[model samples]
Target: MVVDSRSRTRASIVESAAKLLREQGADAVTTRAVAQAAGMQAPTIYRFFEDKEALLDAVAEHVFATYVSSKTLAEDSGDPVADLRAGWDAHIDFGLTNAALFGLLIDPARGGGSPAAAAGLAVLQARVRRVAAIGRLRVPERRAVELIHAAGTGAVLTLLATPPQQRDPGLSAAMYDAVLRAILTDAPALPTGDATAAAVAFRAVAPQLTGLSDAERSLLAEWLDRAAGAV
Candidate 1:
């Protein structure tokens, strides 16, 4: 089919760009180079990608998709904290292995413009939500996510900037533990805790409660959020 053919062509172009990025860094992924690598004319690259920036975004996403497809997690870890640790470790490993892709993702100029960067953040957010569900999260889910993301990204960039022999191997785990100490309570707050802790625990699973109507759930979420934030 024409549609299938077009999809393959676009994928081929992205693949070529990704190869260039990995082999020679971000600056090597020029439109002409990608076109030649994919055995297509330069104008054909434009047909698939609006410009060089769009093509670079596609390449970042393509590389990320391939990397994530190779990683897996247990269906239910029974300990969401452990699951969070695993996710953090995997993220660091991904960054260290894919230095060029990681640099593209964390560049301040790109901000959140890259689809792959958003996807990576979404994965982290989900992992944080899982931690919240178990009532172990001390901070609100959003704050926890941001803290962990920033720390992990910082840790990876720090390591990448260091020469391999000089890199501090313990830095990533140390950073994760530091953030965990700030975010997770000793135990689930649902059973015995102050109102704020209880609110945090309840807010984590409030969406799944069948008895609450949509409006009721919305109101409850607002109130719980307030309760969670109250000192």
Candidate 2:
């Protein structure tokens, strides 16, 4: 019973903090303000969170987890490239809609060890893996993942810095296209004479290579990844 009560209280505090963050931005999420919003004393927040930063971390994770859940719930469209584009669109929309939370999630100091941020990256990696498996990825999976992630972050930060009325609506799409061209091949299957694409295709299937020891598989993956990155 005590555990349940504590969980409820913690959840209430996080929800209240999330609401403040969503509506009024991060500056408005002071402990005193959050406590008042949650109908509790400021000290009660200390009982649940170590400091304002900790509370904000919880709020970020809570909100981002909800958003991630929505992404996971959606049915995949069977086209890996199209599915990746959809994920990118959703990411941009989420960043725009939750500016304060997005800012918090992207902060290098805090985001480095954040589970929420890691989960988001994992989703991107899965999408990239799907593309690699289909022989469309030209670069290594890790390289493709990094390029897409960096581009998306740059696009969101750029748009957020610009005044709403002055922002270019085509900027995100253009960035995605540029990233796709860098990381993906025109052909749906691995093209002959394209060493990078062939390496990437082989890397994608390395895990399922039969008759190979685990260490052998790992070495093969490393070699293939290096070959893909060389191009």
Best by lDDT: 2
Please give the lDDT score for candidate 1. 0.82
**On residues 89-183, what C-alpha lDDT tens digit does candidate 2 reach at each position?**
99999999999999999898885887767788888888888888888988888888889899999999999999999999999999999999999
lDDT per residue for candidate 1 within 109-226, as digits (tens), equals 8666655566667777777787787678778888899899889899999999999999999999999989989988876545475555567778888999889899999999998898
What is the Å distance of residue 45 in model 1 from its true position?
Answer: 2.2
Global lDDT scores for all candidate models:
0.82, 0.90
Q: Per-prediction RMSD in angstroms?
A: 2.4, 1.6
Q: Flag regions of model 1 displaced more than 4 Å.
A: 68-74, 111-116, 188-191
Tell me model 2's lDDT, rounded to 2 decimals.
Answer: 0.90
| Model 1: colliding residue pairs | none
Best by TM-score: 2
Candidate 1 Cα deviation (angstroms), residue 8 = 1.5
